[model samples]
Target: MKNPKPTRQRERHNVYRRVREKIIGLDFSPGSAISENELAAALGVSRTPVREAMLLLTEEGLVEVFAKIGTFVSRVDPEQVAEAQFLREAVELASLRSLSTPLDEEKVDRLRDNLRRQKETGEDIRSFFALDEEFHRGLMDLAGHESSWSTVSAAKSHLDRARMLGIRKIPELGRLTEEHHAIFDAAVSGDAATAERHLRSHLRLVFADVKAVEEDSPELFVRDRDAGPHRRSAFVWD
Candidate 1:
């Protein structure tokens, strides 16, 4: 019989990424119970791999396990979101500072193209989110800080979720797109001070969004542990 090691490893990795994406994308819904048996069946894998993936997610603070209660997709933690926002802003602002006069025409054109695409996305929240990511990564690349963006992306899962929540609350993403344009304009003009200011303000906007969302849907966020357990039904909106 062929060794099952390679197959098992591949299954574990697939399950890990799939589960992580669902949680980060809010597919599973925050604070919702995650059933190991159901997930295993859905993935057509044994419980071992699913359980292993859950363990890794728990370590990442994306999932929580309560003794005898069950495993759950962890609620959005504003503190964690704030920390990610701070790191992202620092790195992006520093990147902006690295830019020199006479920005590359090719790179500037690329950013403009990205903005055009962002406008075309209209009210498609998921599409807008994807383009939003591409636009930021494009800026990092323009500033010769492409490698740093990977680090930022990996650490900003919480921030991404919060941004999504914000999108849901807001009427449209036009303001965010305009903010991107302002930052891009400053960068292309080689105005480091102006660029840094715009970028700083843009990055910090997530906190206000978080506050609005938390006030609207308090159940979707993490509450104090001492307050005791309260499991609210997960509500998924299209």
Candidate 2:
């Protein structure tokens, strides 16, 4: 005998995560249509849970619903991306500063292990991206502020989507991995100042990549802060 409430909640969350990943990974792409019926069929559930999941996404600013135009994957907002990046830097730099001169041996080893795995990922964008996230979150955990990672992650959905688009077009993974190594080296060497400098530079560089991406695909992003949903065809927008 299964409890219906838990099962329903689980199904709703399953749809939410799956759809969220697709949106962030650019599989759905910005301004693309999201068919509730299609997603329900694909996820092997009815429209009830799918609709529930979409309602939540709407609150996250990841989904947009029009009166007659239907729902769509929201466009990447550069302003939102910058705001998220600022929050991420402030939190992560604070964590680095709070770390003791001599870091925990176990945490240092784990950081090194994450870097090694990052190098091994080699062109697997999603895998590398996941590791990149884990590595940053690990830094917070190492500094005794693990719970703060959740707050940072919640605020970074827009930034994450922008990052996926940037990395997909730019061959920056190697450079990014090298930067991670540099940051980790400074952290373990007990040089908080150097570590903060490296991390600030690393976090700031994503905007450069994002700008290049925007230049290439103007339609995928919103330039003006007061912009609203512009209409387009059913299958594509231009």
Estimate every model's Cα lDDT from 0 to 1: 0.82, 0.85
For each candidate in turn, the TM-score is 0.83, 0.86
TM-score of model number 2: 0.86
Backbone clashes, each candidate: 0, 0
Segments in model 2 whose C-alpha atoms lie over 4 Å from true places: 1-8, 67-69, 223-238
Weakest lDDT window of 10 consecutive positions for candidate 2: 229-238
lDDT per residue, candidate 1, 1-238, as tens digits?
2556554578888999998878878888887877777788888999999999999888778888877677888888888888888889889888899987666788889899999998888899988888899999989988888889988987877778888888888855999999999998888877889988988888878568877788787777878855444455353322
With candidate 2 superimposed using the best TM-score fit, by how many Å does residue 160's alpha carbon deviate from the native?
A: 1.4
